[model samples]
Target chain A: MSSIVSRNLKIYFRDKSAVFFSLLGILITVGLYFLFLGDTYTDGLADFNHPEIFMAGWIMSGLLSITSVTTTMGAFGTMVQDKEKKIYKDFYCSPIKRSVLTMGYIISSAVVGLIMTAVVLVITVVYLAANEAIVISAMLVVKMILLSALTSLSNTAMALFIVSLINSEKAFSAISGVMSALIGFLTGIYIPVGNLDEGVQMVVKCFPTSHSAVLFRQILMENSLNEGVKSYPAAAQAEALAEVKDVLGVVFKFGETECSAEMSLLILVGALVVFSSLSIFTLNRKKTA
Target chain B: MNKIVQVTSLKKSYKDVHAVKGLDFYVEEGKLFAFLGPNGAGKSTTIDMICTYLRPDSGKILLDGSEVGKNDDEIRRKIGIVFQDSVLDPILTVRENVTIRGSMYGLHGKELKEAVENACEVVGMTDFMKRPYGKLSGGQRRRVDIARALVNTPKILFLDEPTTGLDPQTRVNVWNTISDLQKQNNMTIFLTTHYMEEASDADYVVVIDDGKIAAKGTPAQLKEKYAGNYLYIVPKNKDSLLNTLKKNKITYKQNIDTISIPIVHTVDSLEILDKVRENIDSFEVIKGTMDDAFIGITGKEIRR
Candidate 1:
């Protein structure tokens, strides 16, 4: 399994195109936020003096959350090619067990996710600092880094489970096509959950990935959110803050019940465990092919 | 039987199609064994079971005295396989490919380097170890695959039509490499090939048709049973040869130029050769080949 893991890592890094293409979704999301929809989203939130920073945190957090997923999906691109070319048959007929091959793919993809997400985090931090938007707190940086690792694991597992169901490059290419185009919107980066209909809002809230968006918004926009509200009188600012939190999924709601940031983190972790178990179980049965 | 591999009552089927039907065969240690059959003869399916890649429906397979499917790792460590298809990562260099495979068997550092060198030496692949796999010719890539399999010094080597797609010259190179490996290491070689001439290199041969073993024997033994030896004589004078044939009571078929006699053994052919010696202008003895034996038993050629 270690050999398989090392080989996958080497293969992924050697293919320059794979590395660049894996981050394409994140790049597209950034492009859309700045050039395509920035003014529209910022113009509506005229109440906040620096709404751009808040939205940047939202988009960057969403990108970090989904990076592990799309990059891992790129990592599994190697496996899909191996299957298509029947190179996997050699490994199958070798002494190595099939479970090893499955595990190797999952672990290496997680590693790929971690590396890509870290690079993106560095870029996000620099961008936030240049704009004088981030709180620049030690605790906030530490929290963001820890959350990046957790989301990387969750996204890798989720990506692997989906990869297990597919056998062809053509099918996976179609999926990646859809993901690059729609993943940002799905994660609430393009359209905030509050602005969408109740049904669409529920999807963004219940979706395991959107949890990362909420956690990020709380940390990255903490200073700006507070400063933006301080200009107004205390009572009106308090009501408005409460309203935005509910609308933007900063605090999740189910009927009268409210979920804290900790609850959302638990959900992401739960998704990681479930998707990983399902991927390993299903792959072990069919990996010999 | 000093067997390296043994299978009894083995059966495998996919849905309604019975791929292998209660097959039985054993490969002796330190000898090349050929599994011969036409296309769809279940040759690969049988290899798959013996290699423990597929589970048999009802049967037993033992490799080097250990049960195959039950102790898969044991069976795996004792054997190395160069598959019929290309299995190398095209983008990686040959050394990288070999090193990764060696790691799987838990060899590293000095041991890995020596094993890699030895394997490449055996297949004459050391010169091209640094080249990208995809850049090499088909024959060179095959040799690299052979090196990968040999790096572990497996006790048994399985070659599933290793030379199927090579040109005539490269095919001979591959066969020579295989023969040299057997001579140096005494490894048991289990091979499947459509080239009937290659079977003559095997110490034993088994013919399968429709998932059943049709015949099994030493190459010489199969020739004796199915493909008869013959003597052909072209006499300068037909009258003299005819008189000798009549007196000897030889059952012979005479074409315009040659008289052919089906003989069972060398002694029989030599006796007839003595009688026709004075009258014959040119005489030749014909020994049966594996191709003849194959056609005699299965009534079809070994190609699709």
Candidate 2:
């Protein structure tokens, strides 16, 4: 299984086009943020004391979620190709257990997700300090890294479940396109939950991936939001922080209850477990031609 | 010789199509066994079950005394398969592709390296091992596929249409490699091929048609039973040849310019040739062929 993992990683990284396209989602998001969305978002928060810093964290958090979704999908392109070309049947002839082969694909995709998300995390921090002129502490960076791992694993499991159903490259490509386009809306990065329809907002709150974005936002914007409202009166600062959290998706509400950080973390862990088991079951049950 | 692979009442179905219908066959140890059939005649279905790639709907498959489904791991460890199409990762170098397959069977370190090297060397691919699989030509790719299959030094090698689409020279090369494995390494080869001439060299041949055994025997036995030996004579005078055959009470088949007479043996052609020497302009004796046997048994030519 380790050898399979190593072989998959080598092939993925060796293909320049595949690696470039794997990161295409993050590149597009960052381009959108740089060319227009950045100013528009900061301008919406014009009255805030530190709009640049807060919006930077918000956009960067969304970028991490996008990385988690797309990189793993790109990694899984190998598995789908193996099936499409009947290469999996060759592997089936060997003594290796079917479940071990499934784990090989799963573990490799997770590794890719983790690595690519870490690269995005670094770029996010650099943008925070260089563009927003905000220097977060080492402790904050550690927390973000930990969150990236959770988000990467959670999203990788979800991608695996979807990929297990696909046998052809065309189907995988279609699923990838749909995933890239819908992820932003699902994570509330393209449209804030408060601005959407109640039905869509309910989906955003219920969606497990949206919780990853919320967790990221909670960590990335913790210092920026506090600093942005530090000059306000004590009572006013509390109200301002709460309002900012709601507006930027740092917190999700189901009716009157605000989802706590613990709940959001639990959701991510739950997504990892539920999706991983589901994917394993689907993969094992599938027979190759 | 001991039976290396045995199937009893094995059956498989694909919805309405019964791909394999209670087929029974056995392959002996260290012998070249050929499984011949027309397209979609359940050749692949049978091989898939024997290779442990698919489960038979009913009946038993035993490999070296181990049941197929019940002891697949132990059985798989002793067998290797070369699929009709290339299955190695095209993006990977030939060495990497073979090495990964080797690792799957638990080969590692120096042992794995030597096995990979030996496999490639056997297929005459040692010089091109570093090249990407996709970069190789069709024939080269076929050789690499063989090398990948040989990496485990399998006791039984199963090749499905191993040379279906290759130039004559390359087909002969692949055939030589397969022959070497059986002769020099003493490996048991179970081959499914569309090329009848290739199956002519097999120790035993089984031809299936419409999901059932059409014929099974040594190549000569099958040809002698289902196919025939014939003598063809182009007559100098058609009327004179007809009179001679009729006067001699020899049964014959007449074509536009030639008459054919079935002969029991090659020497019998001499007797018929002597009788028709005065009336024949040219004459030739044709032995029964594997292709003829295939056509005779299946009632159709082998599909591409």
- Among the numbered candidates, top TM-score falls to 2
Task: Kindly report which residue stretches of model 1 are placed more than 4 angstroms away from their true locations once superposed.
Answer: A81-89, A92-97, A229-235, A242-258, A284-289, B228-285
**Candidate 1 residue-wise lDDT, A1-289, digit = tens:** 7778888988888888877787788888778778978888778777876777776766776777778778888998888888888777667667776677777888899999999999989988888777777857798789989999998898888888888888899998888777767777777777777788878877777888888878877777776677666656877998877777676656767766887889989999999999989987878777554
Give the docking tier of candidate 1.
Answer: medium
- Candidate 2 residue A36 C-alpha distance from true site, Å: 1.2
lDDT of 2 by residue, B1-304 (tens): 8999999999999999999999999999999999999898999999999988989999999999899989999988898899988899888999999999999999999999999999999999999989999999888999999888889889999999999889999899899999998999999999998898888999999999889998999999998887778999999999988898899999999888889998777678998888878877898889888878888899997675
TM-score of each: 0.89, 0.95
Give the TM-score (0 to 1) of chain B in model 2: 0.94
Q: lDDT for each of the candidates?
A: 0.84, 0.88
Where is the poorest 10-residue window by lDDT in model 1 chain A? A223-232
lDDT of 1 by residue, B159-229 (tens): 98989989999999999999888887888899998888888888999989899999999888898888878
Which residue pairs clash in candidate 2?
Answer: none
Off by over 4 Å in 2: A131-134, A230-237, A287-289
